[model samples]
Every structure is written in structure tokens, then in C-alpha cells.
Target: MGAECCNKDCLKPSVIGYGVVAWLSSGAALGVGIWMLVEKSTYSALLASLFYPVTIYILIAAGTFGFIFAVFGCAGAMTDSRCMLALFWITSFVVFAALGSTGFLALYYHDNVLRKDINIRQAINESETNGLKDVINMLQAEVSDKLTFCLLMLSFLS
Candidate 1:
């Protein structure tokens, strides 16, 4: 009985630690997904195809479900509830699958579609909406600033 209790005590801390890590990762995913959704105009306007929006939606869904599952994991670990732990594990697998698919789709697009389809110059020139134009200009200014900084660094090195 004493050995069994010690084993459970060790397991409980490990499970709770895993739950904490999951919580942090899920939060980061959720934050990025929401940021992407909020800035959809900037990204979607630049992209020629529907791939960006689809990936964003998938990311959002995965993050949402991941967060919920993380909560279940923490609760289950704290309470030592078998049912809650089972639910947490099941939901976590689904979230992991969603995230994995999103990653694969992103890699595929980066290799095959993004290079051929995305024309930043054309996107800026053809931008119909004022919002899109603003976003493009903002991005351009940021790039220019970074370039200027790089040039300054090169000059100092020389």
C-alpha cells in the first residue's frame, strides 16, 4: 500500500507538469491563431490562393480544442479521475492531428504554391481595398527599416 501510494504520488506530479506544459503551448497556439485571424486582411490579400485562410482556420480550431483538452488534463491529474484523463487523452490526440495536418499543409504550400503564386509587388499594385494598401505599405516600411539597419551594420563592419 505504501509503495503504491509513492508511485501514484510520483505519477501525479509528472502528469500535472505535463498538463502545465500543454497549457502554455496551447495558449501560445491560441494567441497566434487569433492574431492570424485578426490580421487576415494583410495575409489573405498577399496570397493568391485560399491556402492561407484554410490553414488559419485549422490552426484556430486546433488551438481552441487543445486549450480545452489541456484544462481537462490538469483537472484529471489533480483529481485522479480516470474518465477525465481518458477524455483529455482522446481530445489531445485530435488536436495533435489537426496541428500536424496544418504543419504539413504549410510545408507543401511553401514548397509548391507560395513561390509560384505569391507576388508581393503585384499584390501591392493590385490592392483594391484601402486596408490592404495600408497593410502593404506598413510591411514595406518595416522591410525598408530593416534593410537600412543592415546597411548601416555593413558600413560599420567595412
Candidate 2:
């Protein structure tokens, strides 16, 4: 509706922003998939899992997940399929809302269903990390103490 250009030579419809973002999403998906495959570690999974939902959102839009939504949007713009376009438009609005404001809140809220689940997950992840750190710390302290004792014994023996 708020198209910036209507020139016959303009290949892009309504907004250049959409095409740019579609490609950006495509690139990000490729990057994440590559990172997951190549890295293959626990920390990588943790980091990737943090953005899991966003990845799902991107998948819903287009690219490797299929161009269904985006194709629908494009077709709608071209007036070929109003219903599919309308559906994509609704989702697009939700997605933009989520990205712009508290569509994130609309999609997810800290006071609602996910809050408890997120809290539990975060707590568990943190505890695991802390437990690992504590084990490492204890091992370090024991090593230090043993080293100190060995030096003292060697001094006396000498």
C-alpha cells in the first residue's frame, strides 16, 4: 500500500525492504545450519537453542523451509491469490509486530505460559554451568594444594 516506487522499470513491488529481508533470512538460515553442522558441540547447541524460536519464525516465512508464505504474499500482491495473500499478510503483520514492538510479548509473555517454562529452563541451564565450574574450581584447588605439599616435602627432604 505504501509503495515507495511505482516505476515500470522497478522490478520490486511495494517495498525493497521485503526482498532484502527475505535474502537476509535465507543467509541467516544457511549460516546457522552450517554452524550447527560444523561446530557440533554442547555450547553450540545451547547457543543455537536460545534462538530456536526465531529460527522457526524464519522457517515459517521462506527459504529452506519452503517459500509458501512468501510466495503467497507475492501472489497476493500481484492479485493472483487473495486468500493465501491474506493469510500471509496476517502472519506478516504478526511477525512485523513481534519484531517492532511487543509482538514478542504477544507471541510470548513473561507473565504468561512461557514465563514459568523459560524460568525453569534457564535455571536448569545455569545450575548445570555452575556445577561444572564448581567441579573445575575444586579440582584446581586440590591441584594447588598438592603442588604446595609436594614443594614443602621436597624442601624438607633436601
Candidate 3:
């Protein structure tokens, strides 16, 4: 008589756990991206370039793909399927690269392109749309209030 033994996959649990975390984070990213695009859209008029909306669009795309990749990862882990795992790995890499590039480009545009090209005062003055003007005025008031608050805090501390 012989005793039978079955192989145990030790990494399956960790993979599924990672997939769950990734899925939640991706959903958050998607939500934030959509929210920014829809709610803060008026602020886009102040920008001289398309980078603002483009970055948000990229975030939305990456989040959507990340969600899909996480599903693949969870499915692969559960089924012990190599093909799904490979797809997950590849999609994850693509999403990572896209996010990294978007961050880099945003920083570069803020420092170089925005500073040189965008004049907030000019944008506000040239804005023909009432909504854009209202948004600009609102932002100016908010900034003024924040600056006043900061100054008061500093005076109190000193």
C-alpha cells in the first residue's frame, strides 16, 4: 500500500491578496480621475496647454487597465493558470509605465512649459465664458483667504 500526497501552492494566497489590494486602489484611482475631470473641469480653462485634461484622461485609462489586470491576477491565482498570470504581469507593467510617464510629464510641464507660457492674469482677462470667469474669481478668493489665514497663523506663532 502507498500513501498519496498532493502538491500545495504556497503563493496562491499572497497573489490573491495582492490582487484584492490592487483592485481597490485601482477603483479609487478611477473614481478620483473621473471626479476631477467632471467637478474641476472649469479650472482647465486657466491652462495654456492640453496637458491638464490629458493627464486626467491617462489616469482614467491606467486605472481601467489596472482594474482588469487585478481581475486577471485573482483569476490566475485561483485557477493556477500561467496564461492569465502572464497577462496580468504584462498589463501591470504597461499601467506602471503609463503612470510613471504621466507623472514625469506633469512635473516637466509644470516647471517648464506652464511657467513660461501660462499667464493666469491674462487667461482670466481673456476668458470669454462666464463659467470660466466665475471659476477664476472663486479660485482667487480662495487663495486670498488661505494666504490671509497663513499670515495670521505666522504672526500668532511669532
Candidate 4:
């Protein structure tokens, strides 16, 4: 009889298999995140948004779910929990499928091209607000980076 220690042994009959699962799942998720962030350069929250169609970017949104699955599956694998792995796998599949289907639906609803209509008044407001957000994020990142570097330098000097 297998000893059940906090549901640990119940998770994987094979520790080796669990390790493999975690590695592969985590690797796949890394690839997905890289493709989305690096290849597509979605560095900003506005660009990171999943609510919009991938057609808006036309490069990397297609694989976003794969990365999510990989990441979640990797975590599950690390934890040796069958539940998390299954949850992430199924959810990732559903999300990917939905994104693909939604892309098609957009073809009909938006007539195959993102509408370019603009309300001048709204445009002005949006431009103003978005600009401030962009500036804030940039400044925050810069400040954070500087702080980290200074701390590292201080540590080395010490």
C-alpha cells in the first residue's frame, strides 16, 4: 500500500515522470511567453491585453494560451499535483480554440479589417491618458532598474 502523505504520493506513481512533465510543461510555457513578449514585443499592459483579437498584432497572440498552459502545467508538475496539470491543459486548449474561433467571427463582424473609425474628441482624451500611462510605466521600470543596479553595486563594494 502506498503511503499517502498529504496527498503527495497520490499525485504521481512515478517521480521521474512527474519531473519530466514539469520540465516539458514549463519549457512550453516559456516558449509561449517568449513568443508573445519578445517576438511580438507586447511589453505594455495595453499590448498584453487578451480581450482584443490577435489580428490587432498579427504576430504572437495565437500562441498565448500555449504559454499559459505550459506555465500552469509546469507549476503543477513541480508540485506533483495531477489536478493543476489537468486544469491548465484543458483550460489552455479551450482558450486557444476560443481565440481562433473569435478571430474568424471577427472577420464577419468587423468585416475582416479592424475598423479605423475615430471620434476626434475621444481620440484626444485617449491619447492624453495613454501617453501618461506609457510615461509612468517607462519611468517606473527605469527607476526600478537603477535601484537594483545601485544595490548590487553597493553589495559588491561592501
Candidate 5:
């Protein structure tokens, strides 16, 4: 089928290019998701909600969709099927838009949280409950100082 389609000039050069990009990018995303799952799974178990299960799920979902779309895109290109290509375009657009929105919201919330006059550690320390106090202390100790510094710089620049 692919040979017939190729011989008949059914697949455009642009379609092939798009298919290649989809395959490469999807493969890369899948690799990253697996890496994150391995690297962060321990922290996820230790901190539960604070460790960001939602974020981890999103990463995995992104990779899964990427792989799915890549396969669809390649099949569409190979068989010269308009339906598959259309589905790929629509799904990929939606995925990109969702990721973009999530990223923007994360940055916005982080900046808002850090803009408060009181320091996070100070607030955590002054809280009345001992249970939360211990968790917050653990979180503070585990978090990288460089990440905080980077966020501060970003907030200041903006």
C-alpha cells in the first residue's frame, strides 16, 4: 500500500516532513517521560500530593499522545489518508495548546506565591500545627535553592 502510494505521488514532501517530525518529537517525549518516571517516582511516594502527581501524569499523558499521534501521522503520510492526517493535526494542536496553558498557569501561580512579603520557610515555621510544620520543613530541605533563585530572577525580570 505504501509502495503504491509512493509510486503514485500520493504523499507530498511536506507530509513526509511532518511525519518525520512527529515521530522524532514523540520518541523524545516518550523517553523523557520514562526518565522522569524513574527519577521522580521516589519523591512522588515520599511527598504524595506535594510531589505533584498531576504533573507526573501530565508528562506521561503527553508522551502517550505524542506517540499515538506520531503513528497516525506516519500512517497517514504513508497511505496518503486525509482522515488520519486531519486527526493528527487536530490532536497535536490540542496537546500543544494544553501544555502551553499548563506551563503559563504554573509560572503565574509560582510567581504569585513567591511575591508575598513573608518568606515561605518563615510562614511554615510560624504555623501552629506540628504535622504540617514537619512536612513543610522536609519539603524546604528537599527543594533545590537554585530553582527558587531562578524563579526570583524571572519574577524580577518580568
Candidate 6:
């Protein structure tokens, strides 16, 4: 079925649909990433002092890759290049897997920090030697704030 798709002059609706969806989603992802990076630019220098620059570089790379892959998807669909399509599938799977694992970790950390028994605020106040406690407190506050904001927006929509 896959091989036959390459030879057919008449492209099926499904093929066109897939190409369109891939292109649109990739573009959206790229736009959102850049927008976020730009919006946070004012605080980036301060953030760099406290955190590694690797995450900043990774976000830029991911956005660029998404834009490039969207173009590849459209071209591959138009030209019916099996190799391009295969590469797209492979990369997409890897991206999805990475995102899934990151999401799991985020949720796990969020739950741990929110547990009533964990006195995060107290830990931050008491710890002097390890700076990691401060980082943990910040992460917890950020994640909890974002989650609460999102829920409020969702509730309004519903």
C-alpha cells in the first residue's frame, strides 16, 4: 500500500490531509516557541546566571527543526519521496517519546512538591549550604502557578 502511493499520479485525500495537518502543526509549534522565547527575553540574562544555557539552545533547535520538518513533509508528500516520509516518521516518534517522558517527570515533581507533608517553604528557609533547595522551591512555585492559571482559563472556556 505504501509503495503504490508513490507511483499514483492522483494523490489521495488522505495523503493531502496528512501533509496539511503536519505543515500546520509544525508551523504552530515553531511560532509558539519563538513567541515564548521573545516574551521571556527580558529576564533571560538573569535566568542564565541561575540556570544552564542548554535549555535555551534546545528550544531554539527544536523550533528550527519543526519548521524544517514541516517543509520536508510538504515536499515529500508532493514528490512522493519514500525516504523523506520515513525520516519524518522516525523523527516524529522520537520527539513524541521525549515529550511524553518529560511530561511524566514534570507531573511527578509537581505531585511531590504539592504533598502536604513536604514543607518546601521551610526547606528553602533552613537550607544554607545547598542551593538546590532554592531551585526546587522556584520550580514548584512556577509549575503550580502555571497549572492553576491554566485550570482557571479552562474553566472559563467550559
lDDT of 6 by residue, 75-142 (tens): 77677888887776666666555445534554665655455225545555777754546565565798
Total clashing pairs for each candidate: 0, 0, 0, 0, 0, 0
RMSD of 2: 14.3
- Candidate 1 deviation (Cα RMSD): 5.9
The top-ranked prediction according to TM-score is: 1
For candidate 3, write residues 51-133 as lDDT tens digits: 77788888899999999799999999899899999998888888888889888988777776656445555665786766667
lDDT (Cα, tens digit) per residue for candidate 4, span 94-154: 6556546755755665632233222333454567566535655675798899999999999
Question: Which candidate would rank higher by TM-score, 3 or 5?
Answer: 3
Q: What is candidate 5's local distance difference test score? A: 0.67
Superposed on all Cα atoms, the candidates' RMSDs to the truth, in angstroms, are: 5.9, 14.3, 7.6, 12.1, 9.4, 7.6
Report residue 29 deviation for candidate 6 (angstroms).
2.4
Q: Which stretches of candidate 1 lie over 4 Å from their true place?
A: 1-6, 121-135, 142-158
Model 3, residue pairs in steric clash? none
Where does candidate 4 clash, by residue pair?
none
Segments of candidate 4 deviating more than 4 angstroms: 1-69, 109-158
Candidate rank order under TM-score: 1, 3, 5, 6, 2, 4
Error of 3 at 6 (Å): 17
Where model 3 places Cα greater than 4 Å from the true spot, the runs are 1-9, 113-118, 121-133, 136-158
lDDT of 2 by residue, 13-83 (tens): 65334634654665565465555445444333233344445544443443343234555566655654659
